[model samples]
Target: MKLIFALITGLVFGTGIAISGMMDPAKVLNFFDLAGTWDPSLAFVMGGALVITFFGYRLAWKRDAPLFGGCFQVPTGTDIDMKLVGGSALFGIGWGIAGFCPGAAIPALGTGRWEVALFLVAVVAGFYVRRLLSPAGSAKAAR
Candidate 1:
């Protein structure tokens, strides 16, 4: 049941990404080009998402638990530190360069594009590298 829900959720998310033109690297790249060929569509999409998420969280908080899970897995971390800042900067750099964050990239993999595949491979490699570099306990916490 949980797996079925997950698959359905992923399909819905991918469909939304595709329909919103988020799967197109060129479109995504244009969104970052503030000085030239700037596209504001991504901002609209993000705004829509933020609205939905704000309401969704409000409703979810009223419930005792999720429908398919015993409890929510919300992150408890609230401190701002070097590790957080560095990771966020790295993510932004990757997104600016590749024009594909993990969410959109996963669906883009179906397009049979080598660039998309390569990006995903590098993301996996990054995960492994980070784990290798972290202390044993920190690595587990990273997850």
Candidate 2:
């Protein structure tokens, strides 16, 4: 049941990304090109997602436990460090350059775009690079 739910949820999310023009690098790049032919549609898409997430979180919080867990598996780290900032900057740069973060990229690859393969490879490389560099990443050994 959990696997089914996860697959269904992922399908819905990927569908949303594709339908919203978020899967297209050109659309995202156009949004960034504010001085030229800027597409403001991405802003609306983000706003809609934010609204949905806000409400979803509120609803989730009202429950004592989630469907798959006793409590929310929230991130414990709240520190602002150079590592965090630098990693975020890199992610932002990659997203701007490719317009396909990990989630949407998978479905894009399923649609047979060769570009997504490169994007996925880069994403994996970035993950390994971070694991190699980050001090907090010693948890990998424990896992």
Candidate 3:
């Protein structure tokens, strides 16, 4: 049942990405290019998503548990530490250079692009590298 919901959710998300032209690296790059010919379409998509998420979280939290889950797995972290700052900076650098964030890269896979595949491989490698470097119990606790 959880798997079914996951699949459905992924499908909806991928469809939204595709429909929003987010699957195209050019479109995403254009959004980041403030000095050049900038595109604002992605901003509209992000704004719509933000509005939906704001209202959705409000309604979801009202429930004792999620529809298909035991409880909401919300992040407890609130402090802006070195780890958070470093990770954010690294993510921003990668996104700006490649014009493909993790979410965007995943849906771009459907396009059968080799670049997306390489990006995903690098992403997976980064995850493993992080796990290897993280303190034994800290990794589990972080998750």
Candidate 4:
């Protein structure tokens, strides 16, 4: 049941991504272009998401646990550490270069684009490299 629910959720998310035109690298890239072919549609999509997430979190907080989990599993970290900053910068750089964040890229894989495949491969490689470089007793190792 949990797996089924997850599959349904993923499909809904992917469909939303496609409907919002987020799967198109050109559309996403245009969102970053301030002086050139700037597209404001991505801003609208993000705003819509923020509104939905705000209400969703409020409703979720009223419940003691999630429907398919024992706990909410929210992140407890609050520090503005170097690792956090660096990771965010790297993510932004990658997004600017490829116009595909990991979430959107996953669904874009169905388009049979070699760029999407390469992006996913790079993402996986990054994860492996990070795991390898992280200290044995660091918070990253706990993952």
Candidate 5:
């Protein structure tokens, strides 16, 4: 049931990404081009997602547990540390250079683009690199 729900949710999210032109690297790059031909479409897409998430969180918290989960699994970490800052910087740099974040890239793969495939390969490699460099305890915690 949980897997089913997750698949359905992912499909909906991917569809939204596709419809919003997020799968297009040029469109995404245009959104980031502040001093040039900046496209505001991504902002609208983000606003819509934010609105949905705001209401969804409110409703989800009202339930004792998720519909198919034992309990709500929310992030407990709230502190800002060097690792967090570094990872965020890396993510932003990668997105700016490639014009595709992880979520957007995953759906873009369906287009059968070689660039997307390379980006995903790099993403997976980054994950392994992070795991290898993390502290022993932190690596175990991730698992």
Candidate 6:
């Protein structure tokens, strides 16, 4: 049942991306192109998402435990240090350059887009680079 729900959720998400013209590389690239033919439409989509997520997080935290789980599995890292900032900048740079984010890229891959393969290659390269450079091992090192 959970798997079925997950599949349904993914389908809905992909459909939304398609309907929003987010699946098109041109549309996404246009949004990032400040000097060229710029599209500011994605701002409304991003704003709506941010507003919804803000309230969703607040509501979720009001519950002592998640309804689907005995306890919530949350991250304990509270410090917004240089590493976090740098990583976020790197992610944003990649997104701005490629016009493809991880979420939309998967659905794009399903459509057999070559750009998705290119994005995945970059993602894998980043993973290996992080592994080689980071002092910490995997994310579970603390655990």
Global lDDT of each candidate: 0.87, 0.82, 0.86, 0.87, 0.87, 0.79
User: What's the TM-score of each model vs. the native?
Assistant: 0.91, 0.87, 0.89, 0.90, 0.90, 0.79
lDDT of 2: 0.82
lDDT of model 1 at residue 82? Answer: 87
Candidate numbers, best TM-score first, in rank order: 1, 4, 5, 3, 2, 6
TM-score of 4: 0.90
The better-scoring model by TM-score among 4 and 6 is: 4
RMSD of each: 1.7, 2.8, 2.0, 2.1, 2.1, 3.0
Candidate 6 residue-wise lDDT, 1-143, digit = tens: 66787799799888877667677778888998999999987887778768987999889989998655578776788888887798889889888888888777878888887878988888888777887787476465332
Candidate 4 per-residue lDDT over residues 1-143, each given as its tens digit: 99999999999999989899898989999999999999989999899889999998999899988998788877788899888898889879989988999889999888888989999999988877777777563454322
Which residue segments of model 3 deviate by more than 4 Å?
135-143
Q: Where does candidate 6 clash, by residue pair?
A: none
What would the C-alpha RMSD of candidate 3 be, to one decimal place?
2.0
Residue range 1-143, candidate 3, lDDT tens digits: 88999999999999999899787779888998999979989999899899999999999899999998688998787999888899789878888888888888898899898999999999888778777777573455344
**CA error at residue 29 for candidate 5, angstroms:** 1.0
The pairs that clash in candidate 1 are none
The residue ranges of model 2 lying beyond 4 angstroms of the native Cα positions read: 135-143
- Candidate 2 to truth, TM: 0.87
* lDDT string, candidate 1, 41-136, tens digits: 999889888999999899988999899768988888899998789989998998898888888999988789899899999999888878787747
The 10 consecutive residues of candidate 6 with the worst lDDT sum are 134-143
Superposition TM-score, candidate 1 onto the true structure: 0.91
Report the number of the highest-TM-score candidate: 1
